[model samples]
Target: MSKRYGGKFSPEEGRPPQTPSERGSFRGARRTRAGGRVNLLFFAPLPLAARAFGSGPTELALNLTALGALLLAAWLTREGILAQEAYEARKIARRPAIPRKMFASLLTGLGLGVAGLATSGVSAAPLIYAVLGTALHGFAFGLDPLKDKGMEGVDSFQSDRVARVVDQAEGYLKAMTDAIKRAGDRQAEARLERLQSTVRDMLRTVEDDPRDLTAARKYLGVYLMGARDATIKFADLHARAPNPQARDKYLALLADLEQNFTAKTRALMADSTTDLDIEIEVLRDRLEREGVHLETRDLA
Candidate 1:
């Protein structure tokens, strides 16, 4: 099994793993506003499921159908909420292709309406329930983002390329995470998460300046693929026979990768800063040529 990380830059270098409060790993994490009510949605369909059994032929069918629809609606609603959260988290994102929440609302209404029919057969009550349920669902979960964000002044082609590459990179990180869990070593799992965090920092940097995509492609692609493959191999071998040498070697590989990724992210940010400085200088020159004279202090 892997020992606790004791790399040169690790804060836990001679210490044990710290709790989240001690390390502040989740210091700035945003509290999610999704899925709380969605949990209730799952439970709400239980009565219909209970009623599904021990009923006559017609009532049994209606109850079963209602239960299915309501459960499906709950699932769709949860997914829609998660999608919205992802959209909000990114600096650049496309609108979801499907309006899942709207469909969920309709399903919810249909389920409720069917339930009303099962209980109170052929009446305006069912229709009323359908309308009210749909309305309430709509009001509760709200709508999906209807337009792309952070695309203003950005080339569609470039943004799309970056998005695709980032998606692939994220997939690689996820695989590393999944593989690390198989080793069943908590410290190794924690180290993998920290490494993933470093990679994501690079991702965010590239997203901020799509021009960095060219330079970061290899880091996000080739290097990450190699890391993922190594992680899988290590996990498999470690699962079969635990070895200190192998585990330490894998940890060293993680440390090296983390350092390289961090350096690359810094270089990319430096390049962006240089570009901004150049732009400012050119604008000042243009203003001066236009006979808009200003003292150094005034410019400052």
Candidate 2:
């Protein structure tokens, strides 16, 4: 066992060469707009809870109701911000149907109004609080996206298909990320994020051109599910007992998956370019046949 102390024991042996992507991409996750304000919203309703305990029965009921509404509003507001972030990130996405932020604003108003009602006792003050709170909430956080993004000139049905698959792929990635956290390894979490980013690129490619869905379906669906399951298993195993062998193997698996997904994404882009070329050629031929006489400059 004391023999060379090299090869597999050495850092350079099993480690792959630092790829440009790997070297450049081990950074942190993107910053989200859903952090500070949403977090504060969670704490903001605590005073209502405190007030609920010391008051009479009617006041206590009203305070409790207000607390529930305010907490729900906070939750909705956070979700809305995240949904908006996701919508903005993708090239093609349908509008969120529920408009969570707007609803959150209403709930904030209702909660404040109820809290005021408990103290103000049937006066104009409660209505004023409701209106002011609603306005402030709406002003602080804007409304949800009202229209479908990146849908112009694109076939509705095709875009829908792409959106559906991308959504499923995102769910799988989220699950993998959650499972990895149970292992409590920063390196593993970072590695998982890189893989998730790679998967998202392919997801974006499919979203950009729905035609690629046919080719990349299995990668996004079955392969993604398999990766998620593997991550879950590895995380569970690693959480039970720290194993260098298992960690290295899991990281290696991540590297392999990243490479394959990146290659597949590039291939999809290439196919899209070829399809564009074919379409251009067909158009040129049709124009020439119609005696349009597209010149060299026109072709360019």
Winning model by TM-score: 1
Stretches off by above 4 angstroms in model 1 are 1-27, 297-300
TM-score of every model versus the real structure = 0.87, 0.86
Give a tens-digit lDDT track for model 2, residues 43-109: 9889988888898999999999999999999999999999999988888888998999999999999
Report the number of the highest-lDDT candidate.
2
For residues 1-300, could you state the per-residue lDDT of candidate 1 as single tens digits?
987656878775667675432332244467776657789999998998778787888999999998999999899888888888877877777778888999999999999999999999999999999999999999999988898766567888888888788778888988998899999988878777777877888888988999999999999999999999999999999999999999999989987998898889999999999998788778789899999977766544
- Runs of candidate 2 with Cα error greater than 4 angstroms are 1-20, 23-30, 295-297
Indicate the worst ten consecutive residues by lDDT in candidate 1.
Answer: 19-28
Pairs of colliding residues, candidate 2: none
